[model samples]
Target: MLVLLPPSETKAPGGDGDPLDLAALSWPELTDVRAGLVEALVELAGDLPAARAALGLSPTQDDEVARNAELLGAPTMPALARYTGVLYDALDVRSLTRAQRARADRRLAVGSALFGVVRATDRIPAYRLSAGSALPGRPTLRALWRPTLGPLLAAVDELVVDLRSSAYAALAPVPGAVTLDVLCERPDGTRVVVSHSNKAHKGRVARLLATTTGEPGDVVRLRALLRRAGFHVEHPGGTALTLVVPADWATR
Candidate 1:
């Protein structure tokens, strides 16, 4: 099974691995596109104002632009370790057992704007880019990625659990991939879509799937597995699963 995760805006810096190598990444077919995007970012970084406007960053985030400027020569780290935020914090990869870490390396992949996607163990440098960012003189990221990434994801034979946000998911949607929705059930019998705390829940779900001995090939088994793990899972048909949390535990 392969679990697709969204890339985080915040990343850990100063890796011990060698500089970026497009060929060494998981999907060799994406090397050309990755290289193009990387080059575009580097050029954009030369103009700090344009980079800040394009990336929706403030003056305080100048360091992010600097990171992009050094993308090509920056040190690299595992994709899993490079990403940090609410989701990665909840995944807490640092605490996993050695064997669990190996399983995570195999089962998890993160959706990226610059790289398309990277396996958990893929060594990558920290770079500033987002799915919505529009690089000058380049096609829209969705336009650039969908044709290549869609086919690749569609061709995956194993079960795919997509936990990407709408922005990243639109870049390359996996056909028949099981998606999850988080909701908060209020005492009034009404359920509201979760927003703030959603990533934490998804991170926990990804962790459970990554470490489990059982492999769920389809939605049925996947639902059962999550249910057994104490999640309040609901199947609303199709390839979607809804995880309900009590309103009291919900974040606005």
Candidate 2:
């Protein structure tokens, strides 16, 4: 089973690993595109104003642009450790056992704007780029990624659980991939889509899937697995699973 996660806007800076190496990444087919994007980012970084505007960053976020400037030479860290936010915080990767860590390295992959997709253990440097960012002379990220990334993900044989946000998911959609939705159940019996804490829930789900001994081969089994793991999972038909959390719990 493969679980596709969205990349976080905030990343942990500084790493002990060597500098970026495109060839060492999992999908060698993406090496050219990755190199091109990295070069584009480096060039863009030279023009701080343009880079800030293109990346939707504020004046104070110039450090983020600096990170992009050093993309090629910056130290690297595993993709899982490089990403930080509510999602990664909830995943709590540091607490996992060796066996569970190995499983996570094998089953988890992150959707990246610059690298396309990387395995959990793939060593990557700190860089700032969002799915919606439009570099000066490059095609829209969706246009650049879909043609290649779409086919690659579609060709994967294992069951894919896609937990990417709409923006990243639009870059390269996985056909027949099972998706998840987080809902908050109010006391009035009405359910509202979770927004603020959605990632945390997905992170927990990913953690459960990563550490479990079972591999769900399809949406049905996936739903069963989540349900067995104590999640309030609902299959409202189709390939999407809805996980309902109490309104009070969601607010926290």
Q: Each prediction's Cα RMSD?
A: 1.1, 0.8
lDDT of 2 by residue, 98-177 (tens): 99999999999999999999999999999999999999988999998988889999999999999999999999999899
- Where does candidate 1 stray beyond 4 Å? none
Q: For model 2, name the residue pairs that clash.
A: none
Candidate 2 residue spans exceeding 4 A from truth: none
> Pick by TM-score: which candidate is best?
2
What is the per-residue lDDT of model 1 for residues 1-252, given as tens digits with 9 covering 90 to 100? 999999999999999999999999998999889999999999999999999999989999999999999999999999999999888887888999999988999999999999999999999999999999998778999999998999999999999999999999999999899999988888998998766668888888999998998999999999999999999999999999999988887752
Positional deviation of residue 19's Cα in model 2 after best superposition, in angstroms: 0.5
lDDT of 1: 0.93
List per-prediction Cα lDDT, in the order shown.
0.93, 0.94
